[model samples]
Target: MLIWERPEPSARASLSPLSRDRIVRAAIKLADADGLQAVSLRKVAAVLDAGPMRLYRYVDTKEELLDLMVDAVYGEIPAPPPEGDDWRAEVRSLVRGIRGAALRHEWFADLLGGRPHLGPAALGHLDATLTALRSAPGIGDDPDALMRALQAVNGYVLGAVRHEIVELRAERASGLTEHQWQAAAGPYLARAFAAGRYPALAHVVGNGSHQDPAEMFDAGLDVLLTGIAAGA
Candidate 1:
């Protein structure tokens, strides 16, 4: 069973009393500063000024700690279960809420959609979203359509967020803005474009306007939502 499924143990009185929340928050801080690779039970215990084994009382393994961290992120994303009658708008709200949380916690995008999020906060957010979608015009009552819509939209979110984080981290690591990086690669791109075999790719790169990440995400989401809306 997941940690969330179990009742939380009370903190034992001591100089540094331990609770699951304290351990999870410390783990989150580690992940936020140095990414998921930095998180571990020992590290979290160290943050709490407690020995590693003490954390085992609340969290059994590293995986359980990660599960808690993901659920903590979900706690940050909450939207009203029902928002007027616009299913598209409602979904847009939920997606953007998720995006906002990811931006705040870059490592969050890495873990999200990577596993079954059965934690209370995750289930709460999901339940609210599906309930909102239940009011969607035509397909609301149809479980199959709802599931399809959920899967498609979530797939897009996972892929898009992963790409965005990759780019963002690449920029940070290389010490160059995306535009500067692109400019640095201009020669290689020019050579590729010169090859007549790649005409479509060349044309788009030559004439397509660059989009701010937020704008790109919004535009892509709308395109996707429009397709879903057609069935919606």
Candidate 2:
């Protein structure tokens, strides 16, 4: 008498309710977890338990997928602050919102720098931000100054978020808090200062009162908004 045993399953598995939206979402998750370098149609297909070619029905190429993914992220930013008044305040709120969203998705700021294409969601965010700026009491009907203000706000927020993201990543890599980062670097800073080659740097480093990024962001916002109002 012989006993029968179960055999292992085959390699081919049917794709689950796979749709274009789902695939794009999976691609975003992959990028978020493994960095954008790991994101490709084939990789996303693997995660979806589908064949790589299946994604072609939705996205023509990885570039298309990236555009879609960015739009999806932009959609997450809160809607522009309420209309009708306090437009400068509204603009500031929107600025903070964008920065917060970018921080949540670290790839965002990097994406903003490389490409110029605007997905629907990106356009919406832009329109909303511009609307806030235009409506600001001080922005005053002058198109050029309004444009400058928008550009300044966008640049400031992007820079702030990128800086914060880098600091967070470095902290994680070093396993140190911001205070700890300062503490660990303090001694080296002191030793370098003792040499006296860089008086300006030494004075600034010795001050030990430089604001952290969060504080810097607030101060920068105040100065930028104040200047925008003055320019208007």
Candidate 3:
């Protein structure tokens, strides 16, 4: 429902034709380019060559626009098929799609964490996810159990996205590959291990740390799903 426009700076502000969708797209583009701090109705209106007050026809407050933006971004997420042969596979697919969206739009992962859940797109995401979990064997019978499962999965996805974003930012800033980070950390870790200043940390690092996030996610998912199956 959002419309995109590439405006020329020479266009007169008073002559601009603005719609709610256009305003939202401008805000989203601003956030994508300059981070959330750069987004404002006034700023978005200026980008659209319109006045700030014009945006109020659609969005009453900056908060409302942000809510719409979050929904719009979330709407980009692919909702998993209502029926899949395997529930776990379906859930995994849903998480992966969400993760992909977060990766594509770094601001999305950040926005979801910091914003309140108010939009239908946000609720649609939750509804679809819970619906998938409920479709799983055993979860269909208990609403409370289904709620717990959804919460656990949602938390894991949020944490994973945040971790991924931080790693991406670090990689961009340091220009260090995963291998390079490990290689550089190895020497300092070895010295710490030799000194025995932190035996547990030394033992973990010296034994060859398993910091591969995919492995971590798989292990955590396995535990959560296993626990859900057992308890539910």
Give the top-scoring candidate (lDDT).
1
**Where's the lowest-lDDT run of ten residues in candidate 1?**
78-87
C-alpha TM-scores of all predictions = 0.93, 0.82, 0.80
lDDT of each: 0.85, 0.76, 0.75
Can you rank all candidates by TM-score, best first?
1, 2, 3
**Candidate 3 C-alpha lDDT tens digits along 1-232:** 3212222223234577766667778888898887788998889988987777777766677777777787788778887765555677678767877787777778888776543475667777777777778876678968888888988888888898889889888987899987899899988878878887899887776685575766676777777777766776
Q: Write the per-residue lDDT of candidate 2 for residues 89-156, one digit (tens) a residue.
A: 77777777777777777776677754444777777888877887887656667888777888888788
* Poorest 10 consecutive residues by lDDT, candidate 3: 2-11
Off by over 4 Å in 1: 80-82
Q: Which of the predicted structures, 1 or 3, would earn the higher TM-score when compared with the native?
A: 1
- Model 3's lDDT to the true fold? 0.75
lDDT of 1 at 196: 74
- List clashing residue pairs in candidate 3: none
Estimate the overall C-alpha local distance difference test score of candidate 1.
Answer: 0.85
Which is the leading candidate under TM-score? Answer: 1
Q: How displaced is residue 2 in candidate 2, in Å? A: 63
Which residues of candidate 3, in runs, are more than 4 Å off?
Answer: 1-15, 82-85, 113-116, 195-219
